[model samples]
Target: MKQVHTRFPVMETERLQLRKIEVQDAENMLTYLQDPDVMEYYGLPPFVSAEQVLDEIAWYNKIFTQQTGIRWGITLKDEDKIIGSLGFLNWVPMHHRVDIGYELNQEYWGKGIASEALQAVLAYGFETMELERVQALIEPANLASIHLVEKHGFLREGLLRNYEYGNGKFDDLLMYAILKKDFLASSK
Candidate 1:
């Protein structure tokens, strides 16, 4: 595959805008990242400071410049605050594969924002990024996230034992994936 653009490409949906994570957006992003409920299934503990979010944003930019992967801040069209963040991590252009991850504010749960953002990213992964396979490794307990990926036609490939060691314990993860062909067919 060719090299991805160094700049984070902004993408927009009807109700949300997916753009590069700005330092100014840190506080808004912390509204969810620091929420215990929102970070329940996450491997890392809830963020305790805005500085942590700033570090995360810096990492996002670093990877984008390296052409590895990109993460976008999900913001409401009419609102200035970011409600969530989503993107592909661990991109392997040679293998045409990438891992997807995302988190949203609890307030936005069940409102379809996650779905909309995910669908747009999936389309871009397949069409724009020319990815053949996109995978999401979700904790088994995260039913909502599992459902979101399933709605996009991601198959439950397998359960990896002790997949991630975090929060003082080894966590099991359920791997879900969608192929370019399958996603395209389902979108029709």
Candidate 2:
């Protein structure tokens, strides 16, 4: 792919806005990240301080500048409030692949925000980033995430054993990938 731009115009969907994580989001970001249930599938222990959340937001800002991958703050368009976060985590330029991950506040569960954010990112990855594939490494126990990816037409490749350490034990990973061709075909 050609040299990529680190930031793009804010993308607006029907109900959400996908934009770069900013310092202003630290407070609301904590509101979601600090939630035990929200962090459960994301390998985060309960956050004890808002400062810790700010540190994470700072880290995300650095990641954005480095072009490692973009972390978007998902916000309600009308309310203009951050409800969750979703973005590309691991990006491999040489391999033309990237790892996807996201978390939503428990209060916002079952509302399809995760899916909307995910779909937007996947489209951006394949179309804007010109990637060959984008995959999510989700813990199998996170059934909702697995189904979310499935609903987006990401195919289950296989289970990657002991792919991540989480909660307390080594967890098996469920791999779901959507190749550019696959994404385009599914859209058609």
Candidate 3:
């Protein structure tokens, strides 16, 4: 099994309050996953039942115990309902890089919450995790995600065709990345 990096407590952004996933989030997260349009491009299909979300949350809860940063339930300060989720997985600490992914409720799309969440995580990765780089493997057609990474100063690395067998098709993944220097450079 892949070794998990050391984990930490909750983190937040200007518009988001990212907390560790609890068993309770399973129900609310279903609203985000149940929407077919919201999940079409995502690896999974429209959720059939709440059980599946529970199963996922269960696994994530365990993963969160590890040092490896896995996932977080994305919520708002006022609402505090999990409207989306995001995190790093497949952590390869030796390489100083990790994979980042996130999804939000369709109702919240184009609101720029994704970008805010991503920036906070990127900062955490670079400062707390002491990472030299972080990468996002986005579906080529996922222009929204592409823009999110770009807006945060991630550079286009390249495309990996047939990168993942997801959503019932051959998906090409566009690699976007930010080096530690690059991240600091833009901040200055």
Candidate 4:
């Protein structure tokens, strides 16, 4: 697999633009990251300061430089403000696998924005990244996210008991994944 480290890859969908997370996006990113409803299943506590969001933006850049993964800020085609973010994480080029994660503003829920963004990201992961598998670890109670991945043809693998710790105690996650072959077959 070729490492996309030299330049940030920018992608576009019919209604959205997936681009690098810039410092200018901090305020918009904070808008959703600070929303309790948006952060409920995000594993992190609601951000209370711009400084925390800045650190997050920095992390996005660091991961890209390290070639560990990439995170893209989601914005409307006609707007520059970030309304959400989605991307691959924990990338293991040797294993041809990575974890997918995303979050959107509560206001954008149920509008299919996430589904659209996810479709584009998955295509990039399997095609450009040459990923064999892309997995999403979603909280059991997040029915919306579960449905989103399932709609994209992700199969439920199993429960990962006490998989992650955040916002206080450990929580369980349901593992869902889609293989490159399956994705291509479905698209065809």
Candidate 5:
């Protein structure tokens, strides 16, 4: 399959744009990263400083540069301010698979921003990256996230009991996935 390394991919949907995360976005990223409500199921504790946010942004770049994954900052069509972020992680080109993750500013919750961003990223993953499967590991209690993935045609694989240890505890995660055939069939 093709790899994404020569250039960063920026995607646009009806109401949102998924672009590269930059240093200038640290403040905007910090807003949601520090929100307890936003980070509750995110596995990591709420970020407490700009330094942490910078490091997070750096990791976004690092992953892209290493050709392992990509993370895009989510912004409105007419704005550059990031309200959230999403993308593929743990990308394995040889295996044609990757794990997806995302987080939105609590203020924008229920506004369909995440859904728009997800559609764009999934298109890029399957079409451009030539991926066969995209997976998500979500906390079982994150009903909203579960609903989001379900809405996009991902099927629940099974419960991964105590699959992750984060935020000072072991957390159970529900595994979900959608293959290229599944996505294309749903698109039709």
Candidate 6:
């Protein structure tokens, strides 16, 4: 029932914390953003410098200030470094919907860290933001990501052919979504 606020919200899970991405985070983010395995599915090549990550952080803040989206840096409670980021983009207030996207360091891939971060984000999106639906547009080839969303109860609506023009050519994207009612019910 709470409304989303302009200031970044701090979210916590059992083992991770989701905080606003800041310029100081660029060095930590570069660890995964530059890793080929981590950014393999990204539309562009891996970020090569901390400056690029700074630019990205600026963009993240821009969207948040504009009330369009929010991006959070995922960090383990025991570790001081940021492992990755997850967020909602293309937010439409009238429709009460937003697109979700996320990435994690390869070293932490199998540990369920991504899931913990996502669960917190989803809760805020539905409970605080009062969103009606949350959607994910993933690359068809990214089976791991596909499975991640599916595990969280997102239903695959369909595929968008040439949905994204990335890596020099058009790529197909699998659309998945979950409504607030369904999410709340499942959490019970």
Which tens-of-lDDT digit does each residue in 1-188 have in candidate 4? 56665889899999999999999889998999999999999999999999999999999999898888999999999998899999999999999999999999888899999999999999999988899999999999999999999999999999999999999999999999999999999888
CA lDDT, every model vs. true structure: 0.92, 0.82, 0.82, 0.94, 0.92, 0.89
Which 10 residues in a row give candidate 3 its minimum summed lDDT?
A: 1-10
How does candidate 3 score on lDDT?
0.82
Candidate order (lDDT):
4, 5, 1, 6, 2, 3
Clash pairs of candidate 1?
none
Please give each candidate's TM-score: 0.97, 0.93, 0.91, 0.98, 0.97, 0.96
Candidate 6 lDDT by residue in tens digits, 2-97:
247857899888999899888888898998999988887877789999888989899999888888899999988887678899999999888899
lDDT of 5 by residue, 1-188 (tens): 35565888877888888899999899989989999999999999999999999999889998898888999999999988999999999999999999999999999999999988898889899998899999999998899999999999999999999999998899999999999999999888
Sum up the clashes in candidate 5: 0
Model 5 TM-score on a 0 to 1 scale: 0.97
lDDT of residue 77 for candidate 5: 90
- What is the per-residue lDDT of model 1 for residues 4-86, given as tens digits with 9 covering 90 to 100? 67556898899999998899999998889999999998788999999999998999898787778899989998986889999
- Would you list the clashing residue pairs of candidate 5? none
lDDT of 2 by residue, 85-113 (tens): 87776778888888888888888899988
Model 4 global lDDT (CA atoms, 0 to 1)? 0.94
Go through the candidates in order and give the C-alpha RMSD of each one to the true structure: 1.0, 1.6, 2.2, 1.0, 1.0, 1.7
Can you tell me which runs of candidate 5 are displaced by over 4 Å? none
Off by over 4 Å in 1: none
Name the lDDT value of residue 101 in candidate 1: 94
